[model samples]
Target chain A: MDNLVFERTKGLTKKEFSYCPGCTHGIIHRLVAEVLEELNVLDTAVGVASVGCSVINYEYFDCDMQQAAHGRAPAVATGIKRVNPENTVFTYQGDGDLAAIGTAEIIHAAHRNENISVMFVNNAIFGMTGGQMAPTTLPGQKTTTSQNGRDPYVVGMPIRMSEVLGQIPGAYYVERVSVHNPKHIIKAKKAIKKAFQNQIDGKGFSLVEFISTCPINWRMTPNDSLKWVEDSMIPYYPLGVVKDGDKND
Target chain B: MAKVLMKGNEAMALAAIKGGVDAFFGYPITPQNEIPEYLSRELPKLGKVFVQAESEVAAINMVYGAGGAGARVLTSSSSPGIALKQEGITYMAGSQIPGVIINVMRGGPGLGGIQPSQADYYQVTRGGGNGDYNCIVLAPENVQEAFDLVKESFDLADYYRNPVMIAADGLIGQMMAPVDIDKETPKLDLPEKDWATTGMKNRRTKENKDVDPNIIVSLSLVDTVLEEMNLVLQKKYTHMRENQQRYELINIEDAEIVIVAYGTSSRICRSAMEILKEEGIKVGMIRPITLWPFPEKAFAEIPESVKGLLTVEMSMGQMIDDVKISNNGKLPVGFYGRCGGVIPEPEEIVNAVKDFLGGLNG
Candidate 1:
């Protein structure tokens, strides 16, 4: 008889993901689901799905969910956590949703030290709206709107959200990680789990930024995209814990 | 429970607490600051949630979250702030969540003034947010009515599973009057919020099987699916129109000219009606308590002796469109108004009514 070793986490429903091929949102979603399940909070987790490709994540997350307006996920999560302090609350937001239109909301949510976790997926492009330039878009990166490559002088350099959010005193934990390789994936999952655990321990705001890949938007094969993230993206958005309230304490 | 003098903003705040509000999230704006102030101090003591959000947009979205999570929530703002809230309002309406919003009217085309004006009449009644939707809009004339309607608005919101708005002018927000906070109003038989996103832990179906997790969302990407949702919303609006039309008719039995007004304008019109009665000019008034239902049914009660209608408003001729539509061209309709934070006096409405009658006879 074969020994059963691994199975799908019940934290996620059986619904097929709508993400494009080679996109890491599926991996990230699974990691979050597995984390919630391992923590035994899947039954009480309330996820806020923000605008972008993850806008329909409510269909996949096997937990009570709320889909918020563009860039309003943090506000929505704040509301949920305030009313149900015992329940786990988190927001899944893409770069455009978190770094651009929803800047004020995310900043204030962290400033208030809201006891919630955030999964910020930064792929350097707007995937849902068809590969538009994003606030996290790298300089010299070519996007639909940046036909001639991004000009840092005109559009400004990419924002380092982990750096900005890590500086917030209320933010209990902040980390930047990737899923381009198995080793990084393991590290990424560990960070994501700790973010949720921080909320469980009633620490404060926690966010984990994933250097995810969008092969379709990047105009590359899945393998090529992973290679690019390893070589180019990691150098710019280096992986590591930016802040840890536990370490500070 | 005895009547106590209170500012309009404070009275509404107290009434929300009595209405069983579980949370309030709001931003500070002129003429409505007292509301958030009172709640921020009192909600914490009561173990209720109160948040002073970073902006009006965030506050309204917080209202959406709390409402979706099976809590009675409220948010308050003035004119420009309400404009900022329209985005979240549309989302809440589409998601079919229950929440209360209070808009203390201020002058505006673009931050026109901070003083009282009924300029948001069109925005409030016409579904300020995008989409084919309507929010039940209640216009209260005084502090007592403001309290009563706000308290009742929570029930209306939950009963309809939609947002309800209390539209009051800045005069009402700043003024003080006696209010019986504990006054009884009929409670609605609201349905259970099984759809709320409390969790999926112990929820079970009739067959004793586990239920699926609840999702509060408004996105229907397909055209056909969206159309079906629109039809359902239309049906709800129809029911509201049939059952929720509310108005107060004064001296309409034998009047030659009837006036249409609401909120603070209605108070001025009532005074004008008294002045016109003393002059023997025979004027009547129709005060719309619910603005979205538009009180068109009240027009049918306009006596045949009424030869014309005059709409008096704090804004420049905004509500006159509704007045004309309700009148249906059976009688001539005229308009009188002020704007840019100006309040029309009773004398102006009296003159407008006399002119309307003269124009009809001419």
Candidate 2:
């Protein structure tokens, strides 16, 4: 008899994903669910869903979930973590939700050294609002809002959030990874696990940023989107550990 | 419990603790800074959470998250800070997460001034935030009532699964009065927060085997679905209007003129009533404790002897709108106000009443 090697993680619900075809959000969700299941924290974990495509993430994650206002997930997660310190708390946010209107919230949350994990998904395009320009959108990347492609002089350069957050003294661990291929997917999962582990260990603040894909928003095929992330996206948003407080210790 | 001298803000903080608040999140704004300061000192001792958030926006969102997670939460601010919190407050209302917010209102229309003002009356009662939602507004006239209302506000919030506002002013926040600090606050019987996002573990295994995972969300994109949800909220509001009307009538049975006011302005109006009574001008007063319910019943029972109505406020006549609406134009209602941190003196209110009485005769 052939032994079963793998199964769906219990951290996910029976509900089907609402993400578009070839969207990397599904892979990111699977990785997070698998991490929570392996860590045995799904039952006690609480997730704050952001306002972008994953606004209905509460339906997908088999944990207590709250849908917060646009770009306010960090502040909401701070409240949850502070109120329920014993429970594992995290926020899942997109590029537009995190790097743009929520800059103050994310910066202050890191400054406060809040005991919560943040999963920052940078897709370089606003997927939910139908391909609008995101704060992390690369220069020359065409978006619905930036129809003529992003202008470096008009909008300034793309925000490197991991590097910006790594400078905060309160941030105990910060890493940026990608999920374009199997090898990179494995690496991204490891970084996500470490981020949650730091929070479980009573560390101050931990953030794991995934360079994700939005094929429909990017106006490309799923395979081309993956290749584009590896080529155009990686060159601009260099991946690797930006700050590892535990490693220093 | 014996009555003890306490500032209104301090009394509110103690009441929050006695009321079993699990978390207090706020940022320092003048006329209400004492609230956060007191909570920071006291909540930690009681094993409750207290955080001075970076901004009023973050503070209200924190309250939103804590309340969503089934924790009793509190956040306090003044006019400018309160303006920053309207976005989160609207979200909480949309999500039906219960929480308590204290607005010790200061001057406004920009960062007007940090002195007492009722300019926030329209903002609080008429829905400061966007969308078709109204938070229950509790206006307290003294330190004792402020303390009592803080505790009651939490109960009302959880009972209705909605946010409640303690709309005191700078005078109430800054002044001191005798109150029963150690009074036994009756633990109100409240419904279990089954709708709260309190983990999916046991809920997943409960009686409803086919129920989806518990989620606290406010985003309803579908038009018909949102309309249905709005109708449900409208029904709740209608119920509150019918059952939650509260007001105090003083000597209205034998008066020729009625003065309408709430919070600090009501106290001032009372002093003015005493002054007018000494002058033999028949003056009665209606102090509304619940602002949103608007105490329309009190207006309905206005004595036949009453010739006119006058509204007293610290701002330039915001609550006057509700007073007019409740009065239904049955009596000529006049307005009296002082803005930009100026408190209306008793003599000014008496003169305004005199003017209204003259207009009645004219």
Candidate 3:
């Protein structure tokens, strides 16, 4: 039996990772890299690293990558794709990058029905900046600033970007996946690959939001972090494609 | 070639599209809103790209993405809107991407006025964004130059691998002038087919198969490496300074006073120079066509016998700083201009010249 031996995908360099123990970004990144390798699009794949935790994504991916200011990767991707229209371009973003600062960019990029893909890594918190409350943070989740847990009265409900963005005609494929375990990780890889293929096939505005975990700032064990995502996060950000494919759940 | 009256702002946008710019990202601001609007309609017809970015910052970054892909991309706004774009401009400069930005100068420190002003002379010529980066700045005196310079701005941007600014005043942008769009020019086919994200993939150096997904970005955790990269950037800039200097001279021989100005204010200064000459006051005009590699040699043509220099502008006193620095404190530089949408009349500029001469000759 070929070992389901997990490893960093090929496009990712062998550089030592600085992510916290059990941080899911590494897993998500590997999955994306593996998809690139599988789809035979690695050399043609251009990624835009957005602001926030994923800003340093230029270091993670080996293919042509460019960093954009917070929340502006979608616009950057639009620029590159419009210019070349032949390259496979996608943006790697986090909730803070996509939801907070980049709300307008992603929305308009999708609205324009630009031929590109977006990988949204949502850990419900700002991981690199020491875990601030993110747009996708659970209603009652606690963080560095939200010490007493998120106040629903002030902060309001978390944003469901995949669903909201999926409403646009240009958003051809939109899905929410998680990597809390091997099973979910495999599923995420498939979803990310499909999103990229949609672009390659001339479909537009594809996105896959990964419900990831940040163990260090969650102040919980790796196992507890996974449990928290299942127990707490799911109720808020229900997974599945909002508008694409036969399955919509 | 046929000529038709066209607003400077409209001609600038038209020239960009006709010059092979396919992507335009912009946010509406005074004197330049027509640019984005024109692109919105023109790009769709040409199968080009048009995006009304969320803010000035996002608009400029979008240009960075397209430009990096080797597409001729452009963005336009007034002073305040351009201020928002400064951050993205820094990134574009650092990445050595070629792009064009048009700033229709307006009065300001804050929401100063939409009226034509050249207060941003320093902002446009010097480093507007944080970094040791500079953009090639072009100053067009009339509506026709605004159109012609937009195309030149794109070419120079690629040549220098830096952002280029067409710095014009609200007056120039709003004014109507005849232009010949049919003037034959070289084919602008600079797409790096091997690299530009263009769907046409026949040109990339590396095969698009079975390689790692690469990212195009400006962030770096390695500070030492970043410093080394900046050093390379500085070298490129030095080469650009030597290659891209542009300017014009008018009646400098035996002239005791030289009037230095650019953009809209320079046009008014031209009128003032003509008035002074008619009155038997020996004065010459020196216009800095390219503001960033500011025509320093124009001043070199000014002999030591020249008593002083006057700097006129729509801004209170921005470009005077450049004049003083370029002179190395060798000459007495006097300045006068209006701000907050108040344009300085030619007579006002003449009065300032007269006052400066009295101080220098006495």
Query: Native contacts retained by model 2, as a fraction?
Result: 0.73
Q: What is the TM-score of chain A alone in each candidate?
A: 0.98, 0.98, 0.93
Q: What DockQ does each prediction reach against the true complex? A: 0.89, 0.75, 0.54
Task: Point out where model 3 deviates above 4 Å.
Answer: A1-16, A167-170, A245-249, B182-215
Best of the two (1, 2) by TM-score: 1
Best model number under DockQ: 1
The docking quality of candidate 1, as DockQ, is 0.89
* Residue A242 of model 3, lDDT score: 76
Instruction: Name the runs in model 2 displaced over 4 angstroms.
Output: B184-187, B202-212
**lDDT (10s digit) by residue, model 1, range A161-242:** 9999999888889999999889989999999999999999999999999999999999999999999899889899989999
Candidate topping lDDT = 1
Order the candidates by TM-score, highest first: 1, 2, 3
Cα-based lDDT at residue B222, candidate 3 = 88
- The interface root-mean-square deviations, each candidate in sequence, come to 0.6, 1.2, 3.3
Candidate 2 chain A minimal-lDDT segment of 10 residues: A1-10
TM-score per model for chain B alone?
A: 0.98, 0.97, 0.92
